[model samples]
Structure formats: structure tokens, C-alpha cells
Target: MTLADTAAELRHLHDAPELLQVVNVWDVVSARAIAALPETRAIATASHSIAATFGYPDGEQIPVDLMLDMVGRIASAVDVPVSADLEAGYGDPGETVRRAIGLGIAGANLEDELKPLGEAVAAVEAAMAAADAEGVPLALNARTDAFLRGRDRPRATNIADAVERGRAYLEAGATCVFVPGNFGEDVIAELVAGIGDRRVSLIGLPDIPAPARLRELGVARLSYGPYTQRVMLGALQDLASDLYGGGVLPRDIRQLN
Candidate 1:
């Protein structure tokens, strides 16, 4: 599909009845694996995972050019729609959004990172304008770090802050509001209620309810983020350790050239 078509499909997935479950990928291999899944609808890139693959730490440590290139490669390798995790829009939200769209990405996540609400709002506005000029209707999932940063605050206050930032971002042209770190079913419900009609994306948490339950709670999207990558890497480590201990390698490993 063309970039516009894929973007439209991704945007529709956000508002679809079933929760959009994204198994975030960091590279071409992972992207293809996810794309090959019959249950996978779209592919989202994890910025943290990508940074690690490049030997950089998370928090926008990866250079914007390399990040864009990696995302482009993943998009090229898969037929499914690809959404990029463009952290803090790489300090230039508008240009970053434009480049993402230009690279055939269907959507992107832009985190606010505890910035002043107004500044984040402006960034969203600028991104929307850039996408409009490019004639690509990109799905921009504006992420608020309120819950992540407000662990010490009262629950009520944290939820309130997240909802306020979420609503403002949605009004500023965000396709969805991602509020990570508050995974309880009740808090998730509150976020859904607080956002009111805007799609809400949440990161997966251990104690959090299942995707089915989250869908029932009105969550529009769920993502594994860097956890998926971490799990895969951990498995790789275990495999290497076992091999070093003279354990037999799996048949798949033997087949590798």
C-alpha cells in the first residue's frame, strides 16, 4: 500500500473496536517477524530498543538521522503499517514528523517528557501542520510522562495531571494520548473516562489486566514498548550461556549459515 493508505489504516486501527496491540520492533528482522504474525495488524517501533541496538541509551540518545534511517529500513522491509517512536520529536517535532511521514511511516509517538503543557501542545500543533503540508495524515500519538514522573504524587493528582495533558494534546491534533506507568484497571478506566472520546494508549504492565479487559475498559491501544526487545535479548543471553556450558544448540541455530 502507499504511505497514505497505510497511515489511514493505522489511524483506523486506533479507533477500532478491538484494542490495537502493538509488539514494538527495533530492526528489520523483528519488524518482519511481527509483520508475519497473522494476529499482528500494525508494527510500532520502540525507541529504547532501537537505541540499544545502536549501542546508545534511551531518551533520544540515538542521532535523529540514524533513527530515521533505521525506521525507514523497517518500513521498507514490511508490508504492514509502521509507526515510529520519535522521542520528544528529536527536539524538532515538526521536521521529525515530516521525515517520518516521508519515510513511509504510518504513525508516530511523541512524548512530552514533563515539558510544560503549553510547549508540548505547540509541538503537537507544529507536527500536525508539517504533516498537513506533506499531505500525509499521520497518526500522532502524543505521550504524556505525567504518570511516569509523578510516582510520588497522590494517585488522584497524577491521574488529573495526565488527563489534563492528554486532553490538551488531543485538542492540539494528537491522534491518541499515551499515558504510561499507570497500569491499574481502575486508573486505566479513569484515563479513558478523563480523555473522553480520544484514543488512549497504555504500556503493558505485569499487574495490569489482560488486553481483553483493557479493551473492555476502553483502551484504544496497548504496546509492549522496550519489554519485547528486552525479553528477546534475555533469551539470546540464555542461549549463549547454555551453549558455553556445552549444551546442545537448537536445530535453528545449527541451520544458520
Candidate 2:
């Protein structure tokens, strides 16, 4: 599909009756493996996983150019739409997104990082504006750090904060508001209600409600952040341990790429 078409499809997927489940990929091999699946409608890149792959830490520690290079490679390798995790926008949300579009990225996650509401809204505006100037829909998943940063605040307060920030982002042209944290089903319901049906995105944290339950709760999107890479690494460790103990290597491994 053309970049424009892919972007529109990604935005449309947010309102789909079925929830959008994204298996985050960090590199070309992983991207290809997931893209080859019949059920993969789109792909999302985990910023943390990408950073770790390049020997950088998360939280935008990786240079924007380097991150874009990796995401570009993934985009070239996959046929489906690609949404990237641009954590906190690397302090330059608009320019970052513009360059990403140039690389054929269809969507992206721009984090608010609990910034002041006005500033956060401005970042969303900048990103969406850049996408507009480029004539791409760019499903901007504006994220709020309320719950992630407000672990100690009262539950009600955090929920209220998320709702406030989420509404503001939507008004600022965000395609969806990502409120990532481990919360009770009631909190999730409240978020969906406050944010709007099928307009709230979430991280698939361990032990959280299953995708079926999240879909039932009206979540538009769910993607594991760095957990995909973590699980893959854990498997590698297990294989190495077994090999060291004289266990035979399996010969039935299928070529994923």
C-alpha cells in the first residue's frame, strides 16, 4: 500500500470493533517474522527494544537519527503499516515525525512524559501539524504519563489526570491517547469512558487483563513495549544453558526470515 493509504488504514483500525493487537518488533528479522503472519495488520516498534539493540538505554537516549534509521529499515522490510515508538519525541516532535513520514512510517507514539499540559498539547499539535504538512494521516498515539508517573497518587486522581490529558490530546489532533500502566478493570473502563470508545491505547503489561477482556472494554490498541524482546532473550538464555549442559540442538527450527 502507499504510505498515505497505510496511514489511513492504521487510523481506521483504531475504531475497529475488534481490538488492534500489535506485537512490537525491534529489528528487521523480528519485523519480517511478524509481518509474515496472516493476522498481522500493522507493526509497531518498541523504542526501548530498538535502543537496547543499538546499545543505548530507553527514555530517548538513542539518537533520533539512529532510531529513524532502524525504523526505516524495518519499514522497508515489511509490507504492512509501521508505527514507531518515538519516546517523548526526542525533544523535537514535529521534525522527528516529519522525517519518520519521509521514511514511510504510517503512525507513531509521541509521549507526553507527564509534561505540563500546555506543553504536552503543543507537542501533539507540532507532530500532527508536521504530518499534515506532509499530507500523511500519521496515527499519532499521544501518550500521557499520569498513571506511570503517579503510582503514589490516589487512584481517582490519576484517572482524572489521564482523562484530562487524553481529552486535550484528542482535541489537539491525536489519533488516540495511550495510557500505559497496570490498572484494575474498573480503572480501564473509566479510562475508556473518559477518553472515548476505541480512542484509548494501552501497553500489554504482564498479568493485565487478556486481549479479549481489553477488547471488550473498548481499548483501541494494545502493544507490548519491551517485553517482546525480553521474552526472546530469555529463550536464547535457556537454549545456551541447555547447550552448555550437553543437550542436543533442535534440527527442526524453521527459517523465520
Candidate 3:
């Protein structure tokens, strides 16, 4: 599909009847593998996983140019629409998002680690302007880290604060509000209600409710984040450990094919 078509498809996926299931990828190989899946509608990148793959720490430590190159490669390798995890927009939300859009990225996840609400809203607006300049709508998932960082605070306060941020982001032209680390059904339902019509994106948790249940609670999308990539890396580590332990190879090695 053309970049404009893919961008439109990605934007539509959020409002589709079924919850968008995103298996985030970090590299060309992972992106291609997931893009081949019949169940995968769109490809999303995980910033932490991408940074780790490039031997850099997470939290936007990876150089912006390198990250954009990786994203461009993944987008070029896949037929599916690609959305990038542009962590904190690498300190320049507008230009960063403009570059991603130029590389054919259909969407992006930008986190706000409790920045002043005005600053967060401006960042979203900047990204929107960039996408507008490209004449394509970017599905901007404005993430708020309030819940993740305020676990010690009162739950209601965190939820309320998140709602406040979500509303501001949505009003600032965000395509959705992503409140990662809030997987509890009750809390999710409340957050969804508090945010009203805008979509809510959730992260996969160990105790996360089933997909059907999450849909019932009104979640628009589910993301595995860096967890999916970590699982594959963990298995690779185990294989390497056994390979160096002795001359004997593991008997149950599974082929990608």
C-alpha cells in the first residue's frame, strides 16, 4: 500500500469493531515476521526493544537518526502499516514526527513522563502539525506515565490525573490516549469512561484480563510493548548459554519456518 493508504488504514484500525492487537517489533526481522502473521493488522515498534537491539539503553538514549533509520527499514520491509515508538519524541516532537511520517510511518507512540500538561499538549500539537504538513493523519498515541510513576500515590488520584492528561492530549489533536501499566479491568473501564469517546491503549500485564474482557471494558487497543521482544531475546540467551556450556547442541531447536 502507499504511505497515505497505510496511514489511513492505521487510523481506521483504532475505531474498528475488533480491538487492534499490536505485537510491537524492534528490527527488520521482527517486523517482517509479524507482518506475515494473518492476525496482525498493523506493525508497531517498541522503543525500548529497538534501543536494546542497537546496544543502547532505553529512555530515548538511542540517537534520533539511528532510530529513524531502523523505523524506515522496518516500514520498507513490511506490507502492513507501521507505527513507531518515538519515545518523548527525542526532545523535538514536531521534527521527529515529521521525519517518521516522511519515512512512511503511519503512527507513533509519544510518552509524557509527567511533564507539565501544557508542554505535553504542545508536543502533541507539534506532531499533529508535522503530520498535517505531510498531508497524512498520524495516529498519535499520547502516553501519560502518571500511573506508572505514581504507583505509590492514591489510585484515584493517579486515575484522575491521567484522565486530565488524556483529555488535554485528545483536545490537542492526539489520535488516542495511551495509559500504559493500567491493566486492571475496573481501572481501565474507569479510565475509558473518564476519557469519553477517545480510544484507550493498554499494555499487556501478567495479570491482564482476557482480550474479550478487555474489549468489554472498552479498550481500543492492546500493546505488548517491549515484553514480546524480551521473551524472544530470553530464549536466544538460553540457547547461547547451552551452546557454550558443552559441545552438545539442544535437541529441541525450533526452526523459524
Candidate 4:
């Protein structure tokens, strides 16, 4: 399928109740590999991985154009739905919507924690308006960082604020809500129960609570951010060291050669 076709399919799938597994791809090669998987239906880009590929940190170092280009390349290589981690919506919700639509992306991850909660809500509202104007249903996954960073901090203050921010984000037109960070079963259950019947999407790491468990807890989608890339990098380093240290290359090397 073409990228546009995949986008359409993804938009349709967003409404379904079944869990969608979105694997994060760093480059064209990894994107292609994930696309080849029979069970894979959609792809997500990890900002950290993308920045690392360009020798930059994940702290908004790379320009928006560069990130969009990388996303376009990955989208072109795969026939599956491609959703990008548009960190903070690359500034300016309207412009971000336009750029993503131009790149043939079905959806994007938007966060409501860039600034004060009020500002974040406004940003999401602007993004939704932009997407509506573009005539493309951009699945905006509103992310909250509370559970990921503040759970152990001033527990009461953080949890309360997170729930409030998440509610505001939903009201601002977020199709899904993602609470990242290490969350315990009770927390996860509370979030799932709290969001209750709102078109919210929850995403968690594979290493955390099991994917199946998250699904049972009402998570709409599961994504393994940069875990796969990290694993791959480790394997490559080990293999290269073995080859240079008098170890024979595996049979797979012959196939590539």
C-alpha cells in the first residue's frame, strides 16, 4: 500500500477496540524491518532514537524540518500507518498540523506538559483546529509526564495535577492520552478507570507491566519506544567485537554478504 493508503487505514483502525502495537523505528532500515512484520500495522518514531541517529540529544536539539524529513523517509519506506513523536508539536500547533499532513503521517504524539497546564491545553486545541482545517483526522495522542516522573515525588500534588491536565487535554480534542514512565499496577488501573470511556489512548513500555496486562487494563495501544533500537545497537556492538576478536561471523553474515 502507498503511504496515503496506509494513512487511511490507520485512521480507520484508531476507532477499533483491539490493542495496536506501534513499534518505534529510528531510520529507513529499521522502519522497513518493522514494516515487514506480518503483525505490524503501524509505526512510531522515537525522538531520542532519531536525535541519536543524527548525533544529537533528544532535548529538542534537531530542527523540525530535519525531524519531518526523517519521518517522511520512514513513511515512504513502509506500507503501514506511521505516527511520529512530534515532541511538543514542534512548536506552533497549526504549523505542526500542516507539516504532518504534508508528510503523509496518519497521526502524531502531542504532549500537554510543555509548559503550564493551561498553555498545554490551548496548544492542543490549536492543533486540533489545524488538523480539522486540513481535512485530515490526525490522531493526537496527548502525553502526560506525571506518572513517569513525579509518581515518587510529592505524590498527592503530582497525581492530582496529572489527572487535571489529562482531563483538560481530552477536552481540547486529544483522541488519546498517554501517561509515560514506570507506573505500577494500581496506578495503571486507576488511570484506565479514570479515563473511562473517553476516546483516550494509553501507551506503556514493554519492559514495564506486560503488554497483555496493559491491554487488560484498557490501554488502547502499546509502544516500545527505543527499546528495540537499544537492543539492536547492543547486538551490533557485540557482533563487531567478536569479528575483530577472532570469533567467526554468524551464518547470517554470509547471507548479507
Deviation of model 1 at 215, angstroms: 0.7
Which ranges of candidate 2 are over 4 A from the true structure? none
Model 2 alpha-carbon miss at residue 62, Å: 0.8
Q: After superposition, how far is residue 32 of candidate 4 from its true place, in Å?
A: 0.9
TM-score of each: 0.96, 0.98, 0.94, 0.89
Which digits, one per residue and each the tens of the lDDT, describe model 4 over residues 166-191?
Answer: 78887887777777766567766766
Cα lDDT tens digits for candidate 1, 94-154: 9999998888898999999889988989999999899889887888889999988888889
TM-score of model number 4: 0.89
Using TM-score as the measure, name the better of candidate 1 and candidate 4. Answer: 1
Provide the lowest-lDDT 10-residue window in model 2.
200-209
Residue-level error in angstroms, candidate 2, position 243: 0.3
Candidate 3 lDDT, 117-219, residue by residue in tens: 8898899999999998998888888999988888899999989999999999989888789998845677888899998643888888876788888777777
Q: Tell me, by TM-score, which candidate is best.
A: 2
1-257: candidate 2 lDDT, tens digit per residue: 67999999999998789999999999999999999999999999999999999999998899999999999999999999999999988889999999999998999999998999999999999999999999999999999999989999999999999999999999999999999998768999999999999999999876569999999999999999999999999999999999999998899998885
Name every residue pair that clashes in candidate 1: none
Estimate candidate 1's alpha-carbon lDDT, on a 0 to 1 scale. 0.89
Judge candidate 4 against the unseen true structure and give its global Cα lDDT, from 0 to 1: 0.75
Better of 2 and 3 by lDDT: 2
